[model samples]
Target chain A: MTNVLNKAINEKPVTTGMLLALMAATAYGSSQFLAKQIVTEIAPPSVVATVGLFSGFVVLMGLSIGNLPKDRKAPKKAVVFLILSGIASSAGVTFLYTALELAPVVIVAPVSSVTPLISLSLAHIFLPKMESITAKTWVGAILVVAGVSLITIGSHI
Target chain B: MTQAIIFALLAALGWGTSAIFVRLGLQNLTATPGTAISLAVGTILIGIVAVTAHGPTAFNLNPNEFAWIVLLGVLNYVLGRYLNFNSVNLAGISRSAPLLASAPLVAVAMGILIGGETINSFILLGTLSIFGGVILVATGGGRG
Candidate 1:
């Protein structure tokens, strides 16, 4: 069992990665809906974000404790990046909950989905080796932006 | 409406850029540690905001609501984020991002079924457009 798990972790295939991404998306998307429900009862978006994140942090810390020593320490550069990323993530989630409080899940979820467009653009500019903005990427981004615009506009009227 | 849109856009920017950092960080740290550190930091930052905005009472909640929040934390932060880190580690941002973008589609469906959300033609159309765009981006103009 350990060997199989190790193989799965060490030799992740593209299909597995794609599957994981899909699952993550589904879980995240559902959480938005759930969060909308939670916020209706829980006041202050910050509170919701705090509780949810704190809970996850505790669980993840518990899970990582056993592996802490064996794992190679992250480089200083990576630690910096991770800290920045965590700040960004906190900002993103706080904003997301605030938006959910204001708008319906249908509207908020699609708009937030534009993360990839931004992600792709940022990757293209900063991490050129990580991602190249091809024509298809541009076209898709346009579509996503257009779609988000429609939803945003429609929500108002 | 305007406020919501602005905040949502801000979220898009934050989340989008964070993916890059995750990828970069994963290069040096394993997924579990990377997820733990990032989430821990995020939780602290957001917790501070919550406390500052609403006082310590901001953390207060009824039993039922607290239970739900815990469940959401597990589903989203633990399971979802762990998988997300793995995906980025395995597939890179360009390839995995579009797949993750499909979240809104799932949310729309789940919202309707569970949250009693009413969808209109525009919402449906917009959702489809976004999904199509994500697919196009993922497949690289239908190449594969």
Candidate 2:
């Protein structure tokens, strides 16, 4: 058992990525749960957002602080894109946290999880050279819409 | 109810666009520095909003709430995002995308089990549908 586990763990990229992705899912889900805990009437979304984002930034900086110098050498265009990404990410987080403050996770999680569909569509339009989308992706989008609708109806019922 | 939906949609839009920017940035740079730079910018932006909205009163939380907030930051921002970046970097997007899509399921389960949210067949089926659809949509996007 130990040998099997060790072998699986040792596999490069594939196994490691699977483990990391799984860990990420758990962390993200748990974060939403934690956000719900603090985002009450007593502490508004903005308040919690500020504290949480600050703390997160601080922690991340500590871990990756060594890479700060490399960022300076990166192409200006890359830096600019990263800055834009940051701003957008901030907006996304603020809105999602606020939504959690207002609704149950059942509604908010699935709703916000639709980020992929929109991202893919945007990639097709803006980053067309980078990636291509197929009919299947659109079908998945339709399914996502249907699922969201059902969740809404369920919420109401 | 409407507010929640609208906010969630906006969040989706912002996050979706952010993903595009990250990709563009990655054309010239690696993920760690890119993410660090972007997150730094985001933190500053969010900081300004917090001050404008709350006027520095947000720091008065009790110990429990404070701890929860810290935990949220570390778990979501640090662990969740960092692991995700490494996942895509290592496994390629196609294989990892399906797993990342599972986040909603984890959140939903925790919400029902620990957060005391109520649910029914519609909610269950809907959640499952979205989960499947997200997997399909994300994976269907050519393997990163």
Candidate 3:
């Protein structure tokens, strides 16, 4: 473990990846904060969700234009799943905006951050062959759920 | 308050299930294009509804706010996602996921510092547990 940490810290690519992850986290965190500000102070949650996500779509579409043709060559089922995934992702954003509209970012973020746990369970159920769930995952899941329960309990009390 | 938590959990469910879909979809695709396709599709579903259902006047806003939203959109969905994808490829998920998972911490910090929100004891400890748990999960590893 110490060796892995030492190597990750010393290596350039690993360090770069670490930096990028931190940057992405910052962007995500800031977006939530800004979304809260926008929804609470500037506009309705629906408007904020639509405009913000639509703008993201525009940029992502531009960046990914070259790969657009690749989608067609791909299997139809893949496309369908992608579409469904997209809808779910959109719903997630909409729900998040709504939560932000109603509550503080601090409250909403901790609760919503259980996404990994959800993903783990779904992966275990749907793609058991692809995902290898360890005992550590269950341990972590329990802790996260317990934490979330506490947060909910705290909010009520 | 309960409504907010429900919505938050729903958000998690939407996001969580979407990852499975992405995993299924990506069996034949790579990250960027797959994400691009899914995001475009999602935008069409939710974004269009948010506008059309709410009427044309729903999106009314000043130039300043609009620009800020646009910038944030690019930052979070485009740049942030791009960076995360690249990081996963570079450092591997074990190294990257923990950091990526810390996004809530950043939000919590920003909430207290910039957004001027207060936190109680249970909430603080709960947040920490959630953070620690997420780190443990990420380190334990799932390919997606």
Candidate 4:
């Protein structure tokens, strides 16, 4: 993984931050399917959500403890964003699992797959530096929408 | 269809916003703390949901169900996610995204083998098409 990131960073043309963002996107996409498997066993959506968030918290905390600076204090703004992100993520995972519970795996999969599309679009509107719509993006968006539709249709049977 | 679609869209918005926030929060802290902090907040939120959704029943889970939840909490939430984030950190989004996208295909296989779900012709077509679409996206044109 670091090799890929290094390539993205050292390559004259590609920026490291952009490369990082892309990595985040890929993680987002892959998480959906793996999550689907777990969610199947832990129904009620909320249980899955709780377990996921709690476990992620525990693991991240355990690994990071020794590295903390003794005098460090979190800035108020970052704290706000952290809490907001947490709220948004909790809501997102809950809704995602709700969709999964109601619909077939195939159906839920594509619906949430629209995430990149929405995120990119919203990023264009808000974080203009992060991304902009282009012809290729349009094509990709169309394909994703079509793919999602096909999945939904296929799942009905 | 309407309800599911709406729920999914809501999920997308929440996740998208969270992604942005995760990036922002990471600016100041190390990845581990940032992930843990956000997850802790989320866990509290989920606890609220469990309480409201099941009330007293939430406390009465059977031993089997509780065990599965704990195992899943560790494996799926902690281990699976850590690997995922690490994969992104290592591979870059482009290479990583495609690998991650393979999850759906993996899910299809799991469903058949583990869930005892049968696939028809439609599933084959849909899965293939989804993969094709994802490939196009991962290559992400220089545009949005």
Cα RMSD over interface residues, candidate 2: 1.9
Task: Compare the candidates by TM-score and give the number of the best one.
Answer: 3
Which TM-score does chain B of candidate 2 obtain? 0.87
Clashing pairs in 1: none
**What TM-scores do the predictions have?**
0.86, 0.91, 0.92, 0.78
Off by over 4 Å in 4: A1-43, A70-72, B119-123, B141-144
Q: Which ten residues in a row have the lowest lDDT in candidate 3 chain B?
A: B135-144
What is chain B's TM-score across the candidates, in the order shown?
Answer: 0.80, 0.87, 0.90, 0.78
Q: Model 4: DockQ against the native?
A: 0.37
Looking at model 4, how many pairs of residues clash?
Answer: 5
Against the true structure, whose DockQ is highest?
2
Stretches of candidate 3 off by over 4 Å are A1-11, B141-144
In model 3, pairs of residues that clash are: none
- Which regions of candidate 1 fall more than 4 Å away from where they truly are? A1-22, A70-72, B83-100, B141-144
Candidate 1 residues A39-99, lDDT tens each? 8766678888888888888898899899887655657898888888999988999999999
lDDT of 4 by residue, A29-64 (tens): 445544665566645788767866676677667788
- Write one digit per residue (lDDT tens) for candidate 1, span B25-124: 8887887778778888888998888888889976768898888988888999888977897888887776787788788888888888888888887778
